[model samples]
Target: MLRLISSIIFRLLFYRFPQLAYSQEEIEEYEKMYSKALTSKSEIKYSSNFPKLHFIQYIASTKKVVLHGSNHKGINEFEPRRQTLFNGKYEEAVFATRDGIWPIFYAVFDRNKLVGNFRNACISSDLKYNYYFFSLTRETILSNPWTSGMLYFLPEETFEKVNHSLVPFDEWISKSPVAPLTKIEVEPEDFYFINKVSYHNPKESVIVSWFLYKLRTKFFIKR
Candidate 1:
């Protein structure tokens, strides 16, 4: 009975909020662009000068599609696997995000070259902007051999929200295997903050690094 009630509530919410539902027209247009990008050998740039939350808002308002980014290529199906987070929490799922810019970070970086990596997405105090911070060791940047990555476009049918309170519109997970409709190749230059990277010692506190990054972004907007 409770499950049925939940399903009804979800249906009501989705009906009341059209953005929560998928749009086949939007998906078709995106796939067409993806094909063009492939022929041109160019990145399908999604990064924007606006705040990250704005991108999330645009996604929720305009078109809602699940996105998964990876450093690998030629993956027809995404299998659910155990993933360990920076906080040590473990889950067996195929993870994804609705925020277009966030996935690019995962798509561009070479995971094997880094000993460790940390990232966070936060909203500003005024709630008008969003911040995304990432940390990596200097050696990781220098040693990374690959200059490109892949971004997978997925349907939202088999996905569920992961953290409704924290990132209600962004984080998602699928417990079953998912086949992507298509994928686009991307490069580091495709990310808006690609030039704003901060290399710190792995031993340093991530909190400190994040704080410094905030300051740098505030003081040095052009850099």
Candidate 2:
């Protein structure tokens, strides 16, 4: 049949021209080149001069939080709305807050010191005895190479460099529930670099991650 003749001719041609058969190394090289070409098409290049950011982890205690009024000083009960208590335990509660809560005084950690900021602080969850400061964006984590197991605090410079159309920090604050702003004195020693092996991955926007995955899938695979 014609099919059999074509198959025989194809084999004979390949046998006559051994170069038609690629070696393992040659096939691997071709794949590498193809992947490089595909990646380069949409690859984002960050500046080498971009300053590296550090992650901040605060280790807290269960001791009652004490706040002082103008003339009165007393132990304050954790706000029920701001915290979540275990099934029956009242003393233990998680102090979790969203990315941008405006009019909120945040204790910023810059290397060795805990600085104060009215806004633009990267503070994350408020779980018992552990306060997280670095939050990763869906776009940055999935696309950017620098983002790793250790959540990189979205520094102002880095934030500006990347695309912000997904979830802008200001957008969150605009929709956030109004809360009274109060300055809290946080000790420098209270925070330290959280061990990545133990620290959990920083939460990212689910919607954003889904959207990016859908867009990048074409570049990643061909149907």
Candidate 3:
């Protein structure tokens, strides 16, 4: 059983990280890069040199296709996460996140052009008993928005035990060592809102989703 479990875990890690396929000497180089990344500031380079920003925005543009009442996922999720949660928009769209690591985004579109996007992330629920965390979010723009901008978040605990796992906000806080880390605080599960916001209208949908890789906090986009 132990060998089987080990093999499965090893395969999963290898599948997620190409670096694991390298030799030990190469591993040391990766470690150096990781250490540098640890010290580097948290930022997404917006210049042409950084492909992530463009990719994320591109996804947002595509998301506007079915943004209206067609694939209306945000309509379904607003009840639970709202009235207690928060949201963020990429341009003009407003948004919020849901429980269970499920990512939801809303955007607005007009004449096949994206006008606004709302990107939201949620940190809700504490599964001390089940040992897992979950979240969901959706964004819709008043202009041209994707029919649905879908992103998924993994369990927060996965970041530590698995180096290849997506990093949660907790990881960044760990690196910076905030004063709140002294004691773990799990918010009440009574459908409390985590993060929510609404933005003004936009002339075009200038939002996109880059690679949903976890640097420290969960990141994603729909293109």
**Residue by residue across 126-194, what tens digits does model 1's lDDT show?**
122334555556666556534678887777788886654432335678889998765667777766656
Against the hidden true structure, what lDDT does model 2 obtain?
Answer: 0.23
On lDDT, the candidate that comes out on top is: 1
| Predicted model with the maximum TM-score | 1
Question: For each candidate, what TM-score against the reference?
Answer: 0.64, 0.17, 0.19
Residue lDDT tens for model 2, 124-156:
111211121232322322332121111111112
Where does candidate 3 stray beyond 4 Å? 1-98, 106-119, 123-140, 148-197, 201-223
- lDDT string for model 3 (1-223, tens) is 6544544433322112011133455445433432343356222222233222123323222221111111222222211112212212122222222122222222211114433333333221122210112112233322223332222211121122112122221111011111110111011121111221223233323122211212112332332
Report the CA-based lDDT of candidate 3 relative to the real structure.
Answer: 0.24
| Candidate 3 lDDT trough over 10 residues, lowest sum | 176-185
List pairs with backbone clashes in candidate 2. Answer: none
- For model 2, state the Cα shift of residue 198 in Å: 12
Ranking of predictions according to lDDT: 1, 3, 2
Q: Could you tally the backbone clashes for each prediction?
A: 0, 0, 53
| Worst ten in a row by lDDT for model 1 | 12-21
Q: Which residue pairs collide, candidate 1?
A: none
